[model samples]
Target: MDKKDRSILALLQTDAKLSISDIAERVNLSTTACWKRIQCLNEGGYLRQQVWLLNSKMLGLGVTVFMSIKTSHHDLQWLRKFALGVRDLPEVLEFYRMSGDTDYLLKIVAPDIAGFDRVYKKLIQIAELFDVSSSFAMEEIKYTTALPLDYTHTA
Candidate 1:
């Protein structure tokens, strides 16, 4: 990737709805060149799917829960089953296998405590968990889908 490629990515990250001509103008490239660059980026796996972000509060999903999970099962089969189960849950926005005291972490959004409890019940049935701890987010200080492009390698 070169400087112009990086600029194209930065522009797209800011607003995915920007037209090819708009991107080209901002990056000082021809419309065709910008369009080709974007295609290349997509083919190269640098660009992922684009989707609109909705307002959770307005959609009646005001509660955000960070759930820390601990489990004794480390076998691949158990992990596969657990991962599949968790991934199928629509409430789970983010799930990660972490190092340290927490075995796994899940970021879940729901309408309220009752909604979360329903998810919690389904979660416990998926696997034999050693411990499960949940913390509710009081405020979101910063949230963004855009990633930093400063570390991109240019040629």
Candidate 2:
């Protein structure tokens, strides 16, 4: 990607609603060229699907819990089952297979402690886990969907 593509991506990352003409003006490109570049970015997988970020608090999910999970079973079948089971749970916003003491990590959002307890009950029912520990976040310092564009390869 060149400087123009980087600029375009930066703009889109902030707000995906910008018109082609608006982006073209900022990037110093013709409208058609700007449109083509966006298409290329999408097709080349540089631009992932755009989404509306919803506030958990406003949506009645105020509690944020980070769950560190350790399991005795590490076989393919067990992993697949665990993956499928967790993916079905709506409260789980993010899941990760980690590289340290914890085998897996899950980010769960709940309305309150009671709601979180329900989620925990559901999780233990799904599989046999060696350890399941959760830490509640008191406050969110900073969160963002935008990625830094400085790391992108440039011409």
Error of 2 at 144 (Å): 0.4
Q: Model 1, 19-134: lDDT tens per residue?
A: 99999999999999999999999999998888788899999999999999999999999899999999999999999999999999999999999999999999999988989999
lDDT of 2 at 109: 98
Across residues 1-155, which tens digit of lDDT does each residue of candidate 2 receive?
Answer: 99999999999998878899999999999999999999999999998888778889999999999999999999999999889999999999999999999999999999999999999999998889999999999999998888999998899
Candidate no. 2 TM-score = 0.96
Worst 10 residues of 1 by lDDT: 46-55
Of candidate 2, the 10-residue stretch with the lowest lDDT total is 47-56
lDDT of each: 0.95, 0.95
Q: List the residue pairs that clash in candidate 2.
A: none
